[model samples]
Target: MQFTTRPTLSGTFGMVSSTHWLASQSAMAVLEDGGNAYDAAVAGAFVLHVVEPHLNGPAGEVPILLAPADGEVRVLCGQGVAPAGATVAHYKGLGLDLVPGTGPLAAAVPGAFDAWLLLLRDHGTKSLADVLKYAIGYAEHGHAPVERVGETVETVRELFETEWTSSAEIYLPDGHPPRPGELLRNPALAATWQRLLAETAGAGDREAEIDAAREVWRSGFIAEALVRQAGRPTLDTSGERHTGTLTAADLAGWSAHYEAPATYDWNGWTLCKAGPWSQGPVLLQQLALLPPELPAQGSADYVHLLVEGCKLAMADREAWYGDADGADRVPLDDLLSPEYNAQRRRLVGDKASFELRPGAPGGRTPRLSAHALVAAVEGEGLDALG
Candidate 1:
């Protein structure tokens, strides 16, 4: 008997999918209440912050792709940029080669909160209070902590206790991380939302109110708190403490913007994704490198082709992808050209190739360090597993 891992899911009505059930349910509830996709997404996203803090939080990024019935598809860039003080010289001075995986030094200008607001303001019909209520309820009352949440708390327990005392106050209540499936509450998070709402009390209409809230977040109390914390040195994965480079000026300077999605047409289907700034373009690049006809689903040949294609695409992503600003802008137009992919597709041979090969689009040289090449090979291997 063959048992498939992925079951066929069919639904008569609309469906909302997320990592957590509470988030999916919250989005569904919004839709049931006559809200649009944008409104439902905002509601669900906020719920995720409360229920799955281990996976996502207010400080994270969420690049949203909107396909409106009446309008063309657009990409909302929610990913935050590196702080102004994050420079090669600064890191070199810190005796660090790579960005620390954990700590204030690793922090970016938080984009999630503002991105959600931007979506709400431009596309959604719901008010800030309407979408935020569910998250507030979950945070103030309680939500069942997923197993990974407890495990994450355990992983960072020592750090929280020793340096990040504020985190310990919430994740380690009474000197212990919450057990899995135990009801956990974060009243402080709820209070913060409440305060944000309070600040927008007198703002005129819906759009005006959302704008006011954005101001409060970017230039007001939220910005102040973030800067204060970032200024303090915190323990990191480097076995040392380091202060963040983020500033209120950086927060104030940044805002979420909408851009046309990078797209690829394959086998009568067009796939749109975020631009070169993100890894989204890698999928399109991979498809361009693959054959017109794919092997049977779940087959070894199909998996092999896909994995090989991903390696080539990811290498290019590491080599060519960068911020579309100044001298570092990626030559996306040249990379996505059919001529380029045709040349790259030849790299896929009969056997597995462990070499990390990045194509030279527009005759531009790929400047990857020896260490980075090794890391890319290892990273792509892990990505192939799941």
Candidate 2:
């Protein structure tokens, strides 16, 4: 591959890369201090939550892939489930054919925190205090504000100022967005992490302490706070404000778990990804559909093929993929099978297809949700899968 940047460095100890530099530094520090890769990842993820709040937050979901030195690859599921009250009837009652992309109604059960904690507890060696210290420090002492963060805050300044006052209290300091490179502190977030740490003070062991912190996050003050705040309506993308349906019961009932990843074998390599519940498998499907040999990377033909493949895969995603919870679900096995891919490959042509083509699996008709179909029809559903 041509190097658009510097060549890779040879390392024996460890390496860390993240969207933000501080997160890399934080992970490297953990590794340098004798913590394992899992510990480093946990520390890095928390720092991302602090410094890249505009991109991701503590309340967001994260699906993790862990491949240890001696163990097989595993997927840590952090994708939160829909709240019990988040039923089709409830949303339909509100005249919403689709969940608004932004606002309180879009909020699911918060899963990232428990996901990280679970990774640390099961696969990591560092204590919760150690893993969290970097994030807490950054949140309390302030980190250099990223330009995108400033821009995002500015874009939402009016919304924050008027509708989401709670958000304004955090993002808008003194009624204005923080300038880029300015030191910005989130004392409230820092206190939240600190309080979780404090709750584990009396635990007998590191494992027990981690468990205690998890409990606090689920059933304690965190759950109570989320449930209370969700009672109030918030501004959403539909221009209709709505209260969140996420309850304390939802938070308490959910827990992160590990599962086998969906795998695709090509040549001698075995690639893995999260199940259809996430967007991960779409890439795998695209790869499966492509010819073994192709045009040079970034060439017009290559780009065309990749883009078309992704469009096809995403069509399948929209039609069938969802939380794996029912007896009668999308037949993922048949969809990923070689026979199905060969059939799908035949559909690719010189021209782009605006029509949605979802393959039939075991004669079962693909069920596309009304919202998904709308997104597909509007031509807003295609994602760059490569």
TM-score to true structure, per model = 0.93, 0.94
Q: What C-alpha lDDT values do all the predictions have?
A: 0.87, 0.86
lDDT by residue (134-242, candidate 1, tens digit) is: 9999999999888888888898788889998987888999888877667899999999999999989879999999999999888999899999999898889999999
Candidate 1 accuracy as lDDT: 0.87
lDDT of 2 at 258: 92
> After superposition, which runs of candidate 2 have C-alpha atoms over 4 Å from their true positions?
1-3, 375-386
The all-Cα superposition gives candidate 1 an RMSD in Å to the true structure of: 3.7
Poorest stretch of ten by lDDT in candidate 1: 377-386
Best by lDDT: 1
Q: CA shift at 86, candidate 1, in angstroms? A: 1.0
Model 1 misplacement above 4 A: 1-13, 324-328, 369-386
Q: How much is the lDDT of residue 247 in candidate 1?
A: 94
Q: Local error of candidate 2 at 162, Å?
A: 1.9
Model 1, position 40: C-alpha lDDT score: 91
